[model samples]
Each structure stands twice: as C-alpha cells, then as structure tokens.
Target: MHCLEVNDLVHRYRNGDVVLDGVTLRIPAGSIYGFLGPNGAGKTTTLRLILGLIALQHGAISIFGLQLAAHRIDILRRVGSLIESPSLYDHLTATENLALLQAVHRVDEAKIGDVLDLVGLAGTHRKKVGEFSLGMKQRLAIAVALLHEPELLILDEPTNGLDPNGIVEMRALLTRLNRERGLTIVISSHLLAEIERLATHVGIIHRGRVLFEGTLDELQRRRRTHVALATNDDERAIALLARQSIAATIADGRIVMPAMPNTAIAQVNRRLVDAGLDVHELHTAGDDLEAIFMNLVSN
Candidate 1:
C-alpha cells in the first residue's frame, strides 16, 4: 500500500515562479524512497508542500489515506521529518534536546535512550549539541526525529557533511530502521552513491518536475551498461569494434562500450583475438549513480 501520495502537485512562489509543477509520487509503505535532484531543483519545496508548511497552488497530497491539508495535525502524528538542517537547541545536551521534543510530542521518555542507541549515539547522549561534530549532530537530529517511532521517516541530505565512517553508520542505521522496524523512509539527497546504497525506490526531480520514478532495477534498465576492456593492442581493438559500428570510446589503453549486453563482451573479445589483438583484461565497470543522475538530468 502507498503510505504517501501526491497528485498533480503544483506550488509557486509569490512572484508566480513555479517551483513545483505537476509533481506526483506514490511512496510505498515500508520502502526507502530516494528523492533525488540537484540544488535549486525544488526538492525542498515539494517536501514543504507535502508537510503542509506551505499551501498548494493546485493538486492534492495525502498521507496514509488522509488528506494532508484537511487532516494536518492528525496525519502528521504518524510522520517524522528533518528538512534541510537539524533544528536543535545548541545549549542543550543531545539527550536533553531529544527529551524536550519527547515532551512536546508526548512520546515516552524511555524512547530517548532507545532512539539514541538506534542512531549509534548511545555514548554521546550526554554531549552538548553545540560541541558535537556535524555528523554527530546529524545523528542526534535523526534520533530526535525517531523518538516518537513514526511510521514514515523523512530526511533531507542526511549525510551532507560526514566522513566515510559517518556515512556508513548513517546508511546502516537507515537500513536497519527500514528492514527491522518496517519504517517507510523518504530521503532527499544529492549524494547518488548514498541513495543507491540505501533506497529501494527512486524519484528523480528536476526543476520542480518528477522526471523518473521506479525501482533500482527499473532505473538501470532505462540506462545503458558501460564496460571497459584493456588490451595491449589498443589500436587494433578500437579498429575492430569501430568497424562493427559498436558505440565505444577509448581511455587509458582501454576500449569502452557505453551500452552493450553482457554476452556481447565475449563476442568483442573473440573478434579482438581473431584480429590478432592481445586482450589483457576484460572487466565490467557499470555506470555509477552519478552517471545515472547526470543522464536523467541532462535528458
């Protein structure tokens, strides 16, 4: 079942500039939906409209079968969100800040420790939010957001300023939250690698419009698979593939095919050998998330 739905969502600035135009999405329950787009692409604006922070110019949004605008407070009770940045009191300790939110939301105090541990901040609960590192603070923000254990988790740029370790930890936490707790997550991020690692579904937005929405495999099928093969006879291999009119490029003593089936690589290898070319290595270097993102945005 779809936990969140948006239909023809249209939002514009007061200057009549359309920030979101005819945006629509259906986020399945218990799925990690990656809301991907570059900066100034209206990702945040669409999130705001869904959360009821701004009035929709046209269209409709519903959370868990309830209209977002009409049932604002009640519907929001089941959703937790962290927008562009963390909203926490710098003066308060991590635990204290989370406790304050617990008070406001009427969530149990016992949940504070559980969430802290869940986000891998159990040891830093007493640390002051002001003194924590950017990554640490981001974890605390997620901890606070999860204190109430809402069904849906909304996070924007959750790994904006983290080192490798922090990024891995955040990814693991998100995966666990989704897999173990069965929580639905809607994450907006520019880090394609991070999204690819965590999200089960993807929705690509550009200039306030949703360009693509589907599963990882579905997205991959739309894109071309690239492979790079290295050989001693670079000139011969290039000449051989080019003669067949294969779409290939050369870089660093290797021939690259922008799009070809896996089985075709064998034929190319056979052709190279038949041409008296010495094949050194045949390996597949599939396009990464960045490549996929660029292709979508460019198209």
Candidate 2:
C-alpha cells in the first residue's frame, strides 16, 4: 500500500509564482523514495504542502490512507520531518535540546536517551549542540522528528553540505531507521549520486513537474548497455552482426553493438570465430545515471 499520495498538486503563490505545477506522486510503504530535481524544481514546495506548513492552493494529498486536508492533525501525528536545517540552541546539550521538545511532544523523558542512541549521539553527554558537527546536528534534528515516533520520515536535502564520511553515516542511519522502524522515508535532493545510493524508489521532478516516478530498478532498466568488442576483421564482424540482426559499428577500432543477453553474446563470439575473425575483447559498458538524468530533464 502507498503511504503517501499527491495528485495534480498545483500551488501558486499570491504573487503568481507557481512552485508546483500539476505534480503527482505515489510513495509505497516501507520504501525510501527519493524526490530528485534541480534546485528550484519544487521539491521543497511539495514537502511543505504535504507537511501543512502552507495551505494547498489546489489538488489533493493523502497520507496513510487519509486525506491530508481533512485529517491534517491526525496525519501529521504520524509523520516526522527535518526540512532545510536543524533548530538547536547553541548553548544547550543534545539532551537538553531534546528535553525542551519533549515537553511539547509530551513523550516520556526516558525516550530522550533512546532517541539519542538511535541517532548515535548518546555519548555527547553535556557537550553543547554548538560544538556538534554538522552531521551530528543533522542527526539530532532527525532525533527531534523521531521523538514523536512517526511512521513516516520526510527530509529535504538532509545530506546537503555533509562531508563524505557524514554522507555515509547518514545513509547507514537512514537505512537502519527504515529497516528497524518500518518507516516510509521520503527524501528530496538535487544530488543524483546521493539519491542513487539511498533510494529504493525514485521521483524526478523538474520545473514543478514530476518527469518520472518509479522504483529504482525500473529506472535502472532504462540504462543503455552496449556490448563492445575488439575484433581482428572489423568489416567482416560488422557484416556478421548485421546479418544476425545485432546492430554493430566500428568505433575507434572496436566493434560496438546493442545490448544482448549473455547467450546471444556467446553466440556472436562463436560466429565471429567461425567466420575466421579473431575476437580480442568483449565487455559491456553500462550507462552512467547522470547521462540518463540529463537526457530526461533536457527532453
């Protein structure tokens, strides 16, 4: 079942700036859905609408099988979020900061320690939040969101400005959170590499429109894989491949051909050898995801 659904979302500001234009999304339960786009592509706007930070100008939103507009209070109770930055007191320790929010959330104070451990900040003791690294602060903010134990997690550019180690830490933390808590995570980022590493499902948005929405595997299948081979008789190889219905070309002295199954590749090798052609090298060059993403947004 889908944990969140947005249909034909069109939000225009009073100044006539439409940040979301007929946006639609369906995030499956227990999947880490990556909301991907260039900066200013309406990722933040969509998140804000889902969180009720802004009134919806048009369309519909549903979370956990309930319409968001009609069940805002109830739906929000089951969603946690860290948007843009963490709100932390420079002078207060991690424990102190969570303690402050705990009062409003009204959960047992004992959960403070639990959340800190979950975020791997339990050893901070009384160290001020100001002393924590950016990654630590991000985790703390996530701990804040987790304080209420929401069933879904939404984060906007959580890995932005994080170092490599910090990125890895955040990925592992998010994966563990999803695995252990059964949390449906929706994260937005312009960094393709980050999204590629963490997301189970992907949504590519551009200029306020979702260009693509599907599982990561579905998108990966779109990658263009080609078999490249180095043959002694390039002319004969091309003819042999064409006769076999395998598109082939000689580029930079290598016979490049369209993607084929392993059995087909083997057959091609055998046929080439039988035709008195020496096949030197055979391999597949997988498409780069950045290229695929560029093609999508450009078209």
Return the top candidate by TM-score. Answer: 1
Error (Å) of candidate 1 at residue 157 is 0.8
RMSD of each: 2.5, 3.1
Task: Give the total clashing residue pairs for model 2.
Answer: 0
Off by over 4 Å in 1: 226-229, 240-253, 257-271, 282-286
Residue-by-residue lDDT tens digits, candidate 2, 8-122: 9998988999889999999999999999999999999999999999899899999999999899989988888999888789799999999998897789999999999988999
Structure candidate 2, residue pairs in collision: none
**lDDT score at residue 220, model 1, on the 0-100 scale:** 75
The residue-by-residue lDDT of candidate 1 on 77-109, one tens digit each, is 888988878888999998899889888899878
Worst 10 residues of 2 by lDDT: 284-293
| Top candidate, metric lDDT | 2
